[model samples]
Target chain A: MNDVITLAHGAGGRQTAELIDRVFKAHFSNPQFTGDDAAVLSIGGADLAFTTDGFIVSPPDFPGGDIGKLSICGTVNDLSCMGARPLYLSCAFVIEEGFPLAKVEKYAASMARTAAEAGVRIVAGDTKVAGKGQVDHLFITTTGIGQCLAGVHTSGTLARPGDVVIVSGDVGRHGCTILLARNQFGIDADVTSDCAPLWGTVEAMLGQTKDIHVIRDATRGGVGTVLYEIASQSHVGIHLDSQSVPVHPSVRGVCGMLGLEPLYLACEGRLVIVAPECEAPAILDVLHRQPYSQDAAVIGQVTAEQPGRVILRTEIGAETMLPPPGGELLPRIC
Target chain B: MNDVITLAHGAGGRQTAELIDRVFKAHFSNPQFTGDDAAVLSIGGADLAFTTDGFIVSPPDFPGGDIGKLSICGTVNDLSCMGARPLYLSCAFVIEEGFPLAKVEKYAASMARTAAEAGVRIVAGDTKVAGKGQVDHLFITTTGIGQCLAGVHTSGTLARPGDVVIVSGDVGRHGCTILLARNQFGIDADVTSDCAPLWGTVEAMLGQTKDIHVIRDATRGGVGTVLYEIASQSHVGIHLDSQSVPVHPSVRGVCGMLGLEPLYLACEGRLVIVAPECEAPAILDVLHRQPYSQDAAVIGQVTAEQPGRVILRTEIGAETMLPPPGGELLPRIC
Candidate 1:
């Protein structure tokens, strides 16, 4: 490990995992400590899911959502991934001293609106101010608590050999939008982030079938990284139907212009779900009826061969390995 | 309100309250929304307490503890304020890109040790890295979940006339220690922060009796601010026996040198507890027997006169009103 932390240590890839294992996991090792999206705990005779995320997006605002909206959606989606019903959330803010009060109000309004849409209550919060230049614009960390539905268990390690891998909606819009928003590449694009609270989308699929094995939101390191993690966790190979993966035209254009793989870009509102192959159509049917997952598609399947690897089958019927995610492609994209 | 945020706005005094009222409360108004240390919620057939706190104390490491230890103590104390047994916590960290990995490990170790002492599990966590100068060093936000003790309802609004106010220990060490650590004033005295997880302290009192009306950690704005807040919330007056208030000798010397009131300085591990006069001795007995609250002393009592004001009676038989806390006395003290 490097003596000093680098951006890669926060990239949500191999480096991040290594940092976690050496520092956090080393000290915070406990029975309930989680490597999953949220920690599942039995509290007060009830199964509960808890998670936390910090939002430090460079520009605080983008085409589809701002930091406040993204903060709520990020934690909500995390709980949703655990097959939990989002219930209550607490947000703590560390604002730069000179940040505008009006902008703060705007963010608060966005948070309230987003929390309401997700059917979660914003219950408690704390605010702190750092000296100007001591902090960037502002950062919001939100923690969520949810109730786990009975008999519904979803984890990255639960993927089976015959499970079909499905994505709730189009990918790469979020990462692409953030990249374009940076305006460093001199590329003009009309792409907006696919950032939305996704409890409804997850609920729709769970309502259709409880056979879902693994569910995860592709946030920091995107769908490709998520597949690698799930594959490693479940000890199964992931075989992707490359052409079947959904990507917005604008996102595709942006990725093409920049020579970036769309599959490795972040998506705030999408979920990579693994379930029995027979339940795919029914789950997709329910997802298509929901607002956030209308573009749900079966993009891959879990395979017994080549465990811990992700294979992408191209249009020419050729297969290649998707390189494992490492390094910091974009910092503060979330 | 100012057009832009100021350090005063996060001072945990009048300005912070105004910000919470104008922005947070205006947008997040709901029945379960909190004006206290933690929100009381009934979830999954059990009463629970939820709260979040952000720690950005300058000089991440201080005399008594670092940011990690303070983070756990802050959230645990918040839950303890509500008479809840803290069960779970989630921490989110936003670190500067060039922070030393060894320092991060040290903080993590402190957090683990503190959490174990508090008997709470560090269940979930997230990490994000900002650019080198984007953040001062690192900031941690911890959210806690606790089981609310049955029939043990404590709130700032529950204080009544004749309720005795007790300080769990000598006050002002934390704020004084941080002030000295900054080396701005060129005045030094040996003082350490009173930062500790106080669930055991609160539990001891509850075991003795559940009649405690209010329990609040005198943090950012100190015991003075908490007394004023309780006075306003309960619509009662507070009368202090000034000489009876416990203050460490070094802290008192520092406060005297700086012309600061020890009562208005922060104490992380101390609690300003209010309860009926009849229960004061029993509560004090329990607090005095605890490790962190050995200096527990009766500092004041709630009164019907001078509602919303705190009066201090001196040993010379003189009475003076303790100024209401406002403005920025010290920024990022906790």
Candidate 2:
């Protein structure tokens, strides 16, 4: 497998199989690979869910994470957010030639560790090597499969007017860290990336209560976009008290100085939940017990009147429309 | 979805849902997204299978195709070559900001068209935007889930002595096409990319015979690498007649003049199958009926005596070992 990729590797023949057996199958041994078009696993009557994601973050490797970790976590989080217990992940690596083996090893280790932490296994994978300069060091794609809860029907459109919005943690950390890392700005905040497996938090809330209307991870486009989407999907409007939406002081400082809206900044280890008003406190309590989600907050509520709108009430009692931003303000910070 | 991705999009909140709905969900819609972790699809009780792949090929958009289409085809083909009837595909796009929307749409169209050609639906997807130059314009990740035929115990390691190896069509065309597209090498050949869905050929052959021992699509590392893999997997030796292995005359001339080995070139559309001696002719006939597979030929046979080895009988009737190449002779051609 250490032999460099040539065109012949993708040929539907011996070499392709060898590569599969050595790199993918060797790492992700399962009974599902028992000779079929797709690996067939005994479903055991649980509802199955599937998700796919591509990782193209610049530098493939970054502080506290890499494309590999993102690939696994992205898929696993999607599975869990859908109320599904993640079971397996399939990965593909599209690598540029001349990528260092050391970097590849670290990336793979990160993937292995994150998948293990998330309680999922890498069950299948493929690798394609492109020419140098044709691609960055590496890009990863991950597909996740999971088993769903017996009677949950969570959806962005499922939110009702009385549903309360809960924040899993502070916002703007991931985006701010990526920005500071890229600019080489000397921020003394010890801003380690917020990238982590959120399955624990998801499981905690799911276990505590089943009244959750919608659960989403606050990632790209930040909280503003998420609220807007829920409003549009559920045909409801959202009103957020900016003071109630928690932001780290450092993140606040950065946003204030740069004129970047913290509300629009990305957060990795965070989620916004729409739940019945009665269950918001319980959900928050459960989330806070998790080490990664201590700062969970109740940020807003869903409404029927201002459908498809997301507005934030500033401390000055002024309201501003919170829409999705124009483009990526920072690149490859993930 | 076309805009730059922010950290909030990945947050498990309203923003994340918006990213899915606006970017990914719009592009890939299927039953898989009906709020389940893994898609609950019925393929006439076929064995469930899954494949995942990442696309980091440079120039996200290439001459004949782009990362988007490759992301779709590469994964679909992985399942298809294994005799799986592809059911659904999930896509994840990691885009960099300032990338053109027009190019993204073109790539999307290509992906959608390729999925249709492969008879699979684009079911679930995710989108992440990175900073410019932090990544290429875009990287696509595709995961395919399918149902494999029951009792199709195909394995690279399963090619027993006396198994016949048949290639679906001419090789090296895809690899050479990229050479011209990228290097401006004036070696003109009327070879359109052999880039296509191989499930049609697999379907044709599977319908004709049940004893197809192994199947693989020749991609990176070309025919030689694939053959080496099969030998290693099945713990058997592969013996080939060089004259019988298909190579276009133009490809041959180019290889000779450029000192490149056609056997090591990448192929997108072609597949190689190992079948029992009794089923070889019928399989070839079934493949011949498909226009995409007109050049199907039996180029070699499997053996037991020299396990884990590949021997090619040259045009001059001299036997030589064709080990996997040491490095990538051609890059980004897939």
Give lDDT: candidate 1, residue B323.
90
Tell me, by DockQ, which candidate is best: 1
For candidate 1, give the lDDT of residue A208. 85
* Model 2 per-residue lDDT at A201: 82
Q: For candidate 2, report its TM-score.
A: 0.82
Q: TM-score for chain A of every candidate model?
A: 0.99, 0.83
Per-residue C-alpha lDDT of model 1 across residues B1-334, encoded as one tens digit per residue: 8999999998999999999999999999999999999999887788899999999999899999999999999999999999999999999999999999999999999999999999999989999999999999999999999999887988899999999999999989999999999999998788989999999999999999999899999999899999999999999999999999999999888888889999889888999999999998889888878999999999988999999999999999899999999989889988
Considering the two chains of model 1, state its CAPRI-style docking category. high
What DockQ does model 1 achieve? 0.88
- Provide the DockQ value for model 2: 0.15
**Once model 2 is optimally superposed onto the true structure by TM-score, how far is the C-alpha of residue B203 displaced, in angstroms?**
1.9
